[model samples]
Target chain A: MASLKDRIGVIKLNQKVAKDIYKMVLQFDDMPDDIKGGQFAHVKLNDKSHILRRPFCICDYDISAKTITLCYAVVGDGTKVLSSYEVGEKLQVMLPLGNGFTPDKNVKKVVLLGGGMGSAVLPAIPTSNPELEYYTYLGFANKEKVVLEEEMAKVSKQLTVATDDGSYGKKGFVTNILAEDMAKLKPDVVFCCGPEVMYKALKKALEPFDVPIIVSLEARMGCGIGACLVCNCKVKRAGEEETYVRVCVEGPVMKLSEVVL
Target chain B: MSNLKVNIAGVEFKNPIITASGTFGFGREYDRFYNIEELGGICTKGLTIKPKLGNPPPRIAESYGGMLNSVGLQNPGVDHYLQKDDLYLAKRDVVVIANVAGSTLDDYIAIAEKINGSKSDMVELNISCPNVKEGGMAFGVLPQSVERVTSAVKKACPNKPIITKLSPNVACIADNAKAAEAGGADAISLINTLSGMAVNYKTRKPILFNNNGGMSGPCVKPVALKMVWDCYNAVKIPIIGLGGITSYTDVLEFMICGARAVQVGTYNFNNPYGARDIAKDLATYVEENNMDINDLVGTLILNK
Candidate 1:
């Protein structure tokens, strides 16, 4: 079973990786064996004043070392508070949450796409499914906002990084870059995580391709275990009325076609 | 003489800690963390006459010490709950209270009558759902409306005890409690989420998609305890106190302030094992003290 109970994780490393972004690796006493990529960890800061626990994608994990890394941006008071914590300080973290990305048995080749902080979700996919071949494309606003390019490259068969401005690699959206390369790459399936806007763009851009597109969604969550219906996203499949599914339960990852953008 | 049990409206609970409605969804989600049977009782997610789709995305937002949510009471209609979760909860060792909601009096009666045939031990009326009748006022806001709905549902589901869950967004919460009692309600639960909102200064927009949401967490405990005391003094029926209860001491505070029992809400979001852990802590405290937990009810020593 997944680790459903809260576990204390001592901060092993907490440092800035990019502008407004900090990557913190938490060392736990032990963890469950079945943690998959695309799953998230709900983190509670030390003080009880901040009642809601912030949900962060399990960017990567080292089961042998009993550590899960969380990559987050200083968006508000909760994250700013998270950034100030020092090494050896502990946070209450519930890991291996939500239904993670699990491709079909026959699937072999894969395409990984990330946009900025969403790239944090890509590295763990390869760690979980090391047998599958991966081609990666990453997008960021500019050089200052880019993150996890190096981490993603290690897991991908081939990697492409682009920034909106000419300040970095390519000078346009990564989705457009991937669209240009779709026929040549010809991967079995595509997995992406980015802002909601990116999902819409990817849906339209990849409409020509026959490949299945899966995307991870982010929502303001309460009770990341699905008890509280706070983290809901709408999904509409063929011949079905639109229904809200808990991002914390049915998914943080869902098929792009099914998610009502 | 260690007794952690409490009786509310003739329903005997194993303990005084019931997971609040809307927080515990038919006891399925939290059961994965710990055996939910360990808690005293569970007020299930609010059920409507038909399945409610609720509000759009971004239904939740965070504050300094609390959170705001505009879930719009999205639930798989009463028939769905009866067909699915009711069977699952029937086997649990815990007391199951089916929380029902509706947009009108007919809706409340129809849903209550449906739940009366189910396996739930009690019914909690979540009158916080906005009503279209009477100038779009919520059923829980006005004392007259509280009594009207409570009595109708009480008669409709005569087999089950009725707990009119009051909204704290109203004036004179005590009068509402009295209204529930007058409507022949067996018990009353107070106070539901306080009406509030969280905003974004830069965008000049509200964080929730619904533009407004209900606030709950550790911050609302003071407001909840005061209301519980007010209602306890005003009504003869049992009162189930809730709001931002995070610890066993918070449970004790509710009981001392005249709550027959207390419910743990938002803290369940913080720790999945929160409600069960609190029940365990309360048991240990009572065991160590060798006292009956019920003795603490209405024992607050108010200074002159």
Candidate 2:
């Protein structure tokens, strides 16, 4: 029942964090308490050409400063326009959107797996709940694409960085390390956000572990809410056939088993 | 507070702001954001005889100042609306406008007849959905076809007021509006999303699953306003204007150009409380200007 709030957030900082990726810090007057890991902010671009607001996962939040950090890559015209924005420029943003990851109090150990920019949501898990033990596996296309190692390390007890081209940290996919270390880590719950292919592979690798896995999905959203019915993915419900649900509302975060992908 | 009320074809609305069909769903989705009753009316999604799964994935594609959608009339059908949705909508304080679409003439008649005596305040015939492969935009393009479909729906739902939603994809939108008015339409609402397509250079294909989709958003406002003005001068029936209406100023512009009421379409996606915000701002504008809401309708000055 949480409604979306449109607030003018000033760009406190907008700088390149890694190759093609720029980290932006938006300072708002009143920050809602419900914003959690995996929830995104629908940011409106100042340029008239980009009509739809682009969705970016919340990378971190500074409660005292009332600021939320977003790490996004310049993939298209919208993101390209966002990158050129100067500090102190006001941008329209709809926030605390979609359901975030549900951190179980009973679960003691957690493993957060992120592929590429999917790592954006990792720090929020630990920052929000300091009591819970956290381990993170971050995957990047190469060494140049890696970002936010220090911030993620501050929240996570242990962090592993992997690259596809053997250019940085461990030379393989993040799932490669998770598959080999799952028995030893003994994580009670696993959360992931990444490309569809990575999700399929991770789901298969964790099939034998008997651990519950949740995934954050990405889609080309029209409304970024349930109204447009554009960001739909087929999901399977208990005792019901597979049906399409909006990723923007039903979740950008959902159980891996519930989703067909 | 200023009086923002307006009557369209005998059905009175609290304000001139109605949520466009397809964009507002059944009013449940946006109810969490704002009170549904605060707006003039709620236009339900286009209903068909049977539940439709709609098009495949990539149903939406972003365009300049707008977006394109190929969602082909996906709904739970009219029976579901009558049994379950009616009570939910009836208990609400707002006017409910049932927007119905069909694949054939019989399909339109069947749906209209079923909704005749229901809780619906009015029925908006959507013969102009461009995404559907069959019977949708085809029935809306030509004046003869528009008249035929509108008259048939009128016969089926004699008790309920009928608004024929016109498409802008045709040669002349004003001609189609005249056709609907000639066919005994109680009112006319237009223009539906302009038929458009977006391309992916790398994929060498269209972005939407249906290849071509209907475009709606801020970019379509001028085109929609011009058409509404043309239709207003052409027909005597009330015209409910829509298409890329995002702000209260746009609402006033449409009214000045001769729209009795305006429906907020793509803006609902941009801001969930868009219509509510516009409704509030409109009242402020009316009070500040010390002008009656009705005085603004059809007050556009023609350049000599």
**Residue A212, model 1, lDDT:** 97
Report residue B127 deviation for candidate 1 (angstroms).
1.2
Which of the CAPRI classes, incorrect, acceptable, medium or high, describes model 2? medium
The DockQ scores of all candidates, in the order shown, are 0.73, 0.57
Task: Summarize candidate 2's per-residue lDDT along B264-290 as a digit string, tens digits.
Answer: 988887777789999999988988987
Native A-B contact fraction in model 2: 0.62
Q: After superposing candidate 2, which stretches have Cα over 4 Å from the reference?
A: A1-4, B1-3
Please give each candidate's TM-score. Answer: 0.97, 0.94
lDDT of 1 by residue, B145-206 (tens): 98998999999999999998988888899999999999989999988887787889999999
Clashing pairs in 1: none
Residues A23-54, candidate 2: write the lDDT tens digits. 99999997877778888888888765676778
Question: Which docking band does candidate 1 fall into?
Answer: medium
Q: List the residue pairs that clash in candidate 2.
A: none
Cα lDDT of model 1 overall?
A: 0.89
TM-score of 2: 0.94
